[model samples]
Target chain A: MRQDIIEIRWHGRGGQGAITAAKVVANAVFKAGYKGVVMAPTFGTERRGAPVFTSLKISREKIYDLSPIETPDMVVVLDHTLLEEVDVTHGLKDGGQIILNTPKAIDTYDFGAHKLSISDVTSHALEAGLAPGIVNTGIIGAFAKATGLVSRDLLREAILNEFSVMKPEENARAAALTYDRTVIGGA
Target chain B: MHVIESGNVAAATGVKLARTQVIAAYPITPQTPLTEKLSEFVESGDLPAEYIPVESEHSAMAVCIASSTAGARSFTATSANGLLYMNEQLHWAAGARLPIVMCVANRGVGAPWTVWNDHQDTVSQRDLGWIQLYCADHQQIHDTVLKAFKLAETVSIPVMVCYDGYLLSHTYMPFDVPEQEKVDAFLPGFEPTHFLNPEKPRNFNTVTLPDVRPDLHGNTAPGYMEIRKTLHTDLRAALSEIEKIDGEFGEIFGRGGEPFLEPYCCDDADYVAFCMGSLSYQLRDVVDAMREEGIKVGVMGLKVYRPFPDAAVREALSAFKGVIVLEKALSYGNQGALYADVKSALYSAETRPFVHNYIVGLGGREIKTQHLYDALTESINKEAAVGDEPRWIGLKL
Candidate 1:
C-alpha cells in the first residue's frame, strides 16, 4: 500500500516541453500496461522563461487525489540552472530520486538523502536538431533509464508520437544516447 | 471506445456524443480548451454542428438560449467572471426553462485576480436555478455531461457540468469514451416542451396578476406565485428523474452510480469528510490512510449540489461521529456554502455530530492531503459541537 502510487514532478521553464513530456509519460506509462495514470500541468499565471511545474501519478489503483504533488517520488529538471532558482527537491520522498539535465560530474552537486541521475539532455536535443529549450524528451529518456519507471522503447514511441521529426532516426538516437549516457548515484 | 485526454476534451467529447447542434462559446481560462476542442470538431467535420464564436460570455449564453428556444440542442462553456457576466441570462434561461447544457470549468472569482482552480464561481451561482453537477475526474466530467444533457432535456431544465478549473480541466487520464451509437440510443432527440414557433406567436411571462389570468383564447394560466412554485416542484421532481436517467445510462453505457451522495467506507466510520469535485479525491486518500492507521474514517462526495440532497446528507452524516466539510469556496460573511447546508441538514436529524468547515484552497492555494489529514484528526478529537465560524485550514494566518 505504501508504494501503490509513484508521483513524479517536472520542473522546467514555461516554454519548455515538460508539460507535454508529462502528458507523453502518462500516455506512455498507460500504454505500457500501468493503471490510473494521472498527469497535471500546473496552470500558473507565469509566462515564458518563468518556472513551471507539472506532476504525474502512476498507480495500479484508482488515484483519488487530484491536487498538486506535495510529496513526489521523483523530481525531473529540464534546465540545470533551475536547480538554484527553484526548490527542485521540494517535498520529495526521503530517498527520492532527482534526474537533472547536466554534463557535470555527479559529485560536484550534493542533494542529501536523495539519489541523483544526470545527463547532458539539452546538448543531445540540440545536437539532434530538436528545438532549443524543448529538452523534455531527452531528459525523459534519462528519466526512464534512471528510474526504470517506463521502458526506453515506449518512451521513444511516445516522443515519436508527439513530434514528426524530419531526421527521425536522430530523434530516436537522441533518446538512446541520453539513455545510455545517464549517470545514476548519490544525491 | 476509450481515450486518454484532458478533462476539457472529455467534456467536448460528451458534447459531440450528445449531438449538440448549436455551440456558443467565448473562451475563458480553463474553459477555453472545451470550446476550442468543440470548434475543432465542427471545423474538422467530425461533430456536425454550427459553432458560434461569440465576442463575450454573455452573448455566448444568450446564443445558447436563443438556439434552445429555437428547439435545438445547444452547448456552451465558461468560467470565473465569464460565468458572472452571464448572471442575468442564467436566470433567464431557467425562467424561460430552456434545456441548454453548459460546461463551467470552475475557478476562483477574481478581485485580486487568479487563473487557478476552485469551486467558488459555480457554488456562488447556486441560486441561479440550474441542475448543478460537480465531477471528480476526467471520466466523470465526460459521463456527467452526457447525463446532464439527458437530465436537462428530461425535465426541460438547464444543467451545468462543473469541475475544478485546471485540476480536472488540464489533467489527463484514461476514460471510456462511450460508444456514439449507445449514447444516441440512451439520449433521445431534443423534444422541446415549450418553444418559440414563429407559426404560433404568443407573449411569454409578460404580466400576471395575483389571481388566475385568462388569455385571448379564454385559457386560464396560474399567477406568478404558482409559476415560481411549479418550477421548484418540477426541479424537485427532476431529482428523482435524475436517478432514473442514471439507471438507464448505466444500462446503455455501464457507467452509473448514485447520482446524489456517494458514501465510501462509511459503515462504521467515526468521521466522514464531505466535499465536492476533485478535492474530495484527495480527502479519499486521507480517509484510506486513516483507515490503515486503525481510525474509522470515510468520505461522502456530493454529485448533485442543487435540490440539496437533505435526506441523503442526513442519513450519511448521522452515522459518523463527526462531519468535516472541506470547501474550496466560501460565502463571505458565512462559511462554505456546503457547510451551511450541512449544518441545516443535521439540525433536524436525530443525531448531531461535531461539524466544522475547513475553508481550504480558496483562490487556488495548493491543498495537500496532509493539511486535510491534520484537520480531520483535530475535528475528530474535538467536542460534538457546531459553530458558525469555520476553521480556516492551511491559511497562512
Candidate 2:
C-alpha cells in the first residue's frame, strides 16, 4: 500500500548478474539523488553455480536495517530454474510484479503475484551472440516496463555506467526489445 | 575526563577513542557489556564505524580479521567459549600480522560451563602468537587498549588486552578517558608499519626454506622474529614502550601511569602473593590485612603477561621468602603457565626462596579472600613442601 520507493529482490545463481542488478538499481537510484541500499545474502563459500539472492531497497530516506527483504514490491528472476527450486514469490506482496527472462508464456507456471510476465530474452541474447548471462539486461528492461520504479533513462544510465566495457548500444537495444514484449497485467 | 566505569566500559571507551573503523562481535557474559557499549556508540553515530552483528564468535573474529586486512582499524571482545570458538582465526590474525586489537574479558574455557573470571581463556591462546596484556584495573584496561593498537600496528602483530571476567570486566572504578583530539595527536592516521595494500601487492607469510626459517623466527628479524622469542622480547620491550607511550599520552591526553607492573608491600615484606587481572586488587587488600597481622605479605600484579617480565619477576620475587603464583588457568603438560615461567627466571638466582604455583578460579569459580588466605597459610606452614609443584584450590566435587 506504500506509494513511495519500491523494494525489489533478484534471484539467480551465484555467477549470474542478480547481485549486479541490485547494485545497478542502487547506483541508478543513488544517481537519481535518492537514498538506496543494495544487499546480497551470500553463503558458505559460494561457487560458480550456487544459488544466491540480492535485494534492493530504494527509499527517499536513509536505510538503516541490513536484513533480507521478506516482502518485496517487485521480483526479478535471472534464471527460470530458480522458480521451482526456490520460493521466488515468497515475499512478493499483492499487486507486486514478477519479471522473468524465459522464452515461454507467463501462463505455463502457477506463480503468486499481482502481475506475471515473461520475455524472449534468451533467444534475443543467443541471436545477438552475447553471453546467455545477458538475459539479466532483458529482465531488467522488462522490470522497468512492468513497474516504473525507475525511469528508462535512469536504467540506461545505470547499464552504461556498470557495463562500460561492453558496447552501450547492445545492452540498450536488449532493454528496448524486452520492454515491448513484457505483459503488464495479472496472468 | 574521568568517570566511574567498569573495566569492560573502560576498554570500550579506549576502542572508541582509538577510532577503530570496524567492530565485529557476538556477546558472551563478561564481554557483553563491552560490545553493548560499542553498539551504542555506533547507534548514536558517536563512533564512525561499522559494527557488524555476527551470529557467532568465530565469524565475529573472521570478520574482524578481514576488516583489519581491508585497511580498517578493527576490534572485537569475547570471553570463555567465545574465545575458544575463535581459536582458528586468532592464529590467522597473528600469522597474517594484522593489527587487530581484541579485548578478551577473561573467563574460564569450559565444558562444565562457568560465567566467572579466570585466565583459562587467554591461557589457551598463549601459543597463538598474539601479544597478550593483562590489566589489573579500569585505568590499566583503558591505557592497555590504547597501547595495544600502537604495539600491534608497530610490530605488525595482533594484541589481546585481557582483563578478568566479572571482576575487572564488571567491577566499577573511576578512570580517565583520554580526550579524542589528544589521542589523535598521539596515534595519528594509523600508517601501518606494514599492511595489505593492493597498489604494490606483496605476498605476506610466504613459505620459506629451512635455511631462511632460522632468520624468520624471533628476536632477530627487523619486524619478524622467532615466534616464542618475539613473544618474550616484544612483551619486555612493550614495558618500556608502555612507559614512554604513557608519558606521551599524559603530555597529550593528560593521563598516564606505570601501566605494566604494579608492586605493593614488596619493599620489606617476607612473602608476596603474585597475581594478575582484578584479583590483584583483592590480593592488595589481603596484603594490607595480612600486614596488619604481622604476616609481612606483599602483592605483585603482572599487568603484562606475554613478555613474561623475567627480569622484573626475578628482581621482585628473588628477595621474598614465599612467592605464591596464583593462577586461574592450568598448563596441560606442566604446572601453571605463568608460575613455571616465573620460577624458570629465578633458576639462576642465588638468593631466590620457595616458589609455589596455586591454580585457583578455574571454570569461572569465584576466588574469595578466604580461599586466597587459606592457600597462603597452607603454602607458608608447609615451608619447603610447597616447592615447585602446582597446588589446586577450591575444587568441590
TM-scores, one per candidate: 0.93, 0.63
lDDT per residue, candidate 1, B1-397, as tens digits?
Answer: 5567899999999999999999999989989889889999999999999999999999999999988988899999999999999999998898778889999999998898998888889999999778899988888899999999999898888999999898889988889887788989998889886678878875654777888888778999788778778778888889889889989988887776788877788888888899999887778888888898899998888999987878878987886778888898899987789999998988998888878788888878888788888888888877414566888777886
Fraction of true contacts retained by every candidate, in order, equals 0.77, 0.00
Supply candidate 1's per-residue lDDT for B162. 92
Chain B TM, every candidate: 0.97, 0.89
DockQ of 1: 0.61
Location of the lowest summed lDDT over 10 successive residues in candidate 2 chain B? B208-217
lDDT per residue (tens digit) for residues B96-179 in model 2: 778899999988766777777678889878888787888876778898898889878776678999997766675444567867
Summed backbone clashes in each candidate are 1, 4
Model 1's C-alpha root-mean-square deviation from the true structure amounts to: 2.5
Listed in order, the DockQ scores are: 0.61, 0.01
Worst ten in a row by lDDT for model 2 chain A: A36-45
Query: Model 1 scores what on Cα lDDT?
Result: 0.86
Q: State which candidate has the highest lDDT.
A: 1
> What DockQ class does candidate 2 belong to?
incorrect
**Which pairs clash in model 1?**
A111-A187
Q: Please report, in order, the local distance difference test score of every candidate based on alpha carbons.
A: 0.86, 0.75
